[model samples]
Target: MTGAEAEGVRLQKVLANAGVASRRVSEQLIVEGRVRVNGVVVTELGSRIDPENDLVDVDGTAVQLDQSKRYVMLNKPTGVVSSMKDDRGRPDLRRFTKDWDERLYNVGRLDAETSGLLVLTNDGGLAHVLAHPSFGVTKVYIAKVEGAVTPQTVQRLLRGVDLDDGSIAADKARLLSTSAEGGGSLIELTLHAGRNRIVRRMMAAVGHPVVELVRRQFGPLHLGTLPAGRARELTKVERGALLTLARQAAGDDTVVRDGGEDPHTDQEI
Candidate 1:
């Protein structure tokens, strides 16, 4: 092997880049001696392998460097848990991803009662950026509340709401539609917070108590009419848009937007 090939990349980094797991988790796997190189168990953290020439395996599965990453958008249905597996026998996101052979995990989470766009991917780096609130990745939701959502309520939501966790504010909130007799209303809200049940908590804090909440868009990807409980691989254009969004959120000016706009407005839902 050439000197450059002999040097190779760090084993953990190779595993992470291959979407086996996050870098930290990959290190854990290495330390546990679950990773093998050239048919020998390797637990050294600094070990490196030429992915092209070295025989690397994790838990008996050959670690082949994937040229194509898998990115899936699932229109999760209510009552299904956003998990790969559930110990309590609850419906899980796995039901939609069973056909996929590549290892993937949900980017973020949707509670059992909430439904709509949930991104699942084998790209750990992108998933980390999208899930981190510091990235300011916007998530838009349409909330049907128990009370008539007035202009004042939208103003209140924009101004901020106090939850048990902390203060939270919506980037934008507007009434989409209201039921007759002024009993209930469908309101569109946009926010960057990733706190658990944040949308439901925010609406409840404003005395409007969410009756049904559906995420309409995540970053540049929209739920559209994808049908509930079904998953589809993201198109090349969609994947590029998501990566662009992640780069922009990370303050990486080197990457251009490529004419893809952030789906932050109510009209995009």
Candidate 2:
């Protein structure tokens, strides 16, 4: 055995530790040519690698190997800024992250008035791809708007509308329901738009200004009934899905011009 292989971790053990499966199952997967390291297929059970430095994947999905890297899902509440600290004394995210020892930051912003899911993590590479508009990662949001949202409004959102910045469109948009007394409507939108206050702008263009907005999903991750202002560590399956999304995004060449690519900064509605 080479000195480096002896010093490194076994492939199956690495996969097992990464939560892919049991050691035996991981070995079987390797033998079946379902594992890869640095883009090269590996079927050798005895192969070892530096988990900290080498990238690994099983069946085209990425595996999180670094134990120190943390992925957190937070249900951000309205009236709190998407930052860890607020210079103007406004409420920030410090309270939610106080229990964590690691320095975590939001992967993308949700406006102070907009509440819902925000991915908090120390993994900058994954955050970069997730937050970048060019990756075309879809986000789901439910918005309460001022007027009655009709099928025409949904069609407008799907067909695209011109804004001050440029033209924009939602991958999917529908009127979920309407409030009988308040003359407000709930609309759900699936989009990859990252422009500042994009949802508000789009609704306003359709004559239904948004009154409240809550993002419910980001890529493969969902808010899933988590109460506002709470945070939790991601499950193994969630981590696998998230890492897989980021991996797929990294190789995409689609051009998306929406702004706010920096995950550390808050910029969307």
Candidate 3:
């Protein structure tokens, strides 16, 4: 085999590529002495091993890097927590995809009271990029407020809201035409920040408490025609589009090596 293909790779990256868990979890495994390199217990997080030359084991089983990447989009239904599991016995995101044995984690979070698009994947780099606020991925939400949104309220949201953490603002927002009618107004809001319940709290701070909220879009990814409680693997074009948008947000000039855009691109707006 070529030297490039036989070169040594890092332990944490191997675990990440194996789809066993995230890089964070792999590091934890190293710290907990659950990982071994060549039969020697390895607790060092920085340890490296050659995929073909080294015998790296986690819990006594060998792990090999997964060349095939998987990306899934779930229309997260309300009441499911954004976790693989919970000790409090509360509902978790795992209930939605019980058929898969491959380890996958949520790309970002949606509160128990909120619902809509959620990304699941084993790609650590992609997950980190999407979750990082510095990437400025615009998350679009349709918020149902207790009363009609006034111009003043819109101004407050656009300018910024003072939360306990500090000032927060949306990238953009405007009233939307929805079937809910006059009881409550539907406002579309965009934010790059992923603070805890940020969208709900921001509107609440302006005296326009949200009655219901649905995340309609995340960057170039959208809920589209996917019905609630259903999910599908992301198409190659969709995945590339999301990566391009995220890279652009991070000030990177990532030109598409290949593939076209998704037909559902406009759904994010």
Candidate 4:
């Protein structure tokens, strides 16, 4: 065996263990020039790589080869706090995550009264990029608010509204429907979650206080049909999307687990 191969782990094994596929399929992918290491196509069957330092991608999507790094999506039900543990002793994230072996934490937060897509991961670097408002990562929310919302209200939301802290606006706002029974309106608003209770506050400022709110999307992730109170590990495609966004948000393509703990992990939406 060459010293280079001896010094590094087999590339196929790395890909397979990273959930690319089985060893045989990974070998096929490598031999077919479908895998790249550090920006170079590596087709040799005996190819090996420094798993920790080398960047790898398959079919143009960056692959996170660390086995310990986990990304999970939870459909957080209303009333559960966004932390691993709540100091107030309220329903917390632990109930949904207790079964996982790795310690996962929320990338950001949804208000206790709100529910929907929440990302939990052990990858601190990605969390930092995603949680910090400075990155301008946007979230989509469907808020059911009081009273019949008019076209004027939607236009106002799209234009901007002044709150006590500052002026805020939705990137997109559309009236979804109106409740005939309660005379409430369902409005979908997409905006950067840059402040505390921004959605509820914005709705209140528009004279349609939110009765219920649920986040439907965060960055590139969609809540989909995942049931409330259930959590699922992100699929390979989803992981790739997140890694892509993290790279864009952090302005670094080589973001890694050891990038450091995200201090803004608990930042609320």
- Tens digit per residue, CA lDDT, model 3, 128-244: 667777767778999888777777788889999999989998889897743445587789999988788888888888877888888888778888999988888876457656655
Tens digits of per-residue lDDT for model 2 on 72-187?
99999999998878899999988998888988889889989999999998877778778878878889999989967778879989999899999999999978998767789999
- Residue 39 error, candidate 3, Å: 40
User: Residue 256 error for model 4, in Å?
Assistant: 3.4
Model 4: lDDT equals 0.85
Q: How does model 3 fare in lDDT?
A: 0.71
195, model 4: CA deviation in Å? 0.8
Best by TM-score: 2
Q: In lDDT terms, how accurate is model 1?
A: 0.77
The parts of candidate 2 lying over 4 Å away from their true place are 1-7, 179-182, 252-266
Off by over 4 Å in 4: 1-6, 43-46, 179-182, 261-263
Compute the lDDT of residue 259 as modeled in candidate 4: 56
Error of 2 at 237 (Å): 0.8
- In terms of lDDT, the best-performing candidate is 4
lDDT of 1 by residue, 1-269 (tens): 23654477998999898777899999999999999866678998987777755555677554545444577999999999877788999988777888788776787888888889998877665676677778788999999899777788899899999889789999999899987786799999998888878888888898888888899899999998899888999864576577657655655432222212122111111
Query: Lowest summed lDDT over 10 consecutive residues: which window, candidate 2?
Result: 252-261
lDDT of each: 0.77, 0.84, 0.71, 0.85
Better of 1 and 4 by TM-score: 4
**TM-score to native of every candidate shown:** 0.70, 0.90, 0.67, 0.88
Q: What is candidate 3's CA lDDT for residue 165?
A: 86
